[model samples]
Target: MEVTSPPPSLLLSDSDLEDCYDIIDPPLTTSNDGSTVSEDIHKSMDEFDRLINLDRARRKMALLNEETEKEEEKK
Candidate 1:
């Protein structure tokens, strides 16, 4: 039987490895369209703020209703 060597595994050079970044790192902030990155960020932030405000509320008698954190609906 002829002896054959195993295929060489692909390995990066030391410099290449040093230049590589963590795989879990978020990708560069970018916009696929012509809009700028900052503009995209602002747009997303505005939408988030709107959604957050929807569930937000203030109690005038918070001092009286200090028993529970969530307000229950009167069924």
Candidate 2:
């Protein structure tokens, strides 16, 4: 008898992808000792900061677009 492996395409699902994302992008945590931060927690905080900056930039762009449209209307 011989053993065979399934195709790569059949091995993963949406849940698996979400689990991977959660592992890579974990929730942020703050240190209680005020001494040092864990590497995983630091990484999570960095990811969070990046997401917040991106969101702020998106909102600023939208506001700028609205302002530009208003100026166009004044012409």
Candidate 3:
């Protein structure tokens, strides 16, 4: 089977398609890193939407990465 990159919608802005093929982020445990990150930056949904989008993109990309890895191994 031939491997293919994930569709564009499944990608994160900070990441390249090749990056996903090479490195997948570690799974998020019930507690991720045990710390609050980038706090105090958003006071309202208007400002917070970007962060929300990024988090969603990251999760989508990670799932796609895992799927791709599994397919590659099977091949």
Alpha-carbon shift of residue 38 in model 2 (angstroms): 1.1
Q: Clashes in model 2: which pairs?
A: none
Look at candidate 1 and tell me the lDDT of residue 51: 75
- For model 3, how does the per-residue alpha-carbon lDDT over 3-73 read when each residue is reduced to its tens digit? 99999888677557557744675423333544322232333554689789999999999999999999999
lDDT of 3: 0.68
lDDT values for all models: 0.63, 0.83, 0.68
Per-residue lDDT, model 1, residue 30, is 72
User: What does each candidate score in C-alpha RMSD?
Assistant: 9.9, 10.3, 25.2
Pick by TM-score: which candidate is best?
2
- What's the best-to-worst order under TM-score? 2, 3, 1
- Relative to the true structure, candidate 2 reaches a TM of 0.50
Tell me the tens digit of each residue's lDDT in model 1 across 30-64.
Answer: 75666756678889999999877764533435644
Cα lDDT tens digits for candidate 2, 1-75: 999999987887989988987799764555664533466676789999999999999999999999999999999
lDDT of 1 at 68: 48
**Model 3 misplacement above 4 A:** 1-43
Instruction: Answer with 1 or 3, whichever has the higher TM-score.
Output: 3
Better of 1 and 2 by lDDT: 2
Instruction: Tell me how candidate 2 scores on lDDT.
Output: 0.83
State TM-scores per candidate. 0.33, 0.50, 0.41
The count of backbone overlaps in candidate 1 is 0
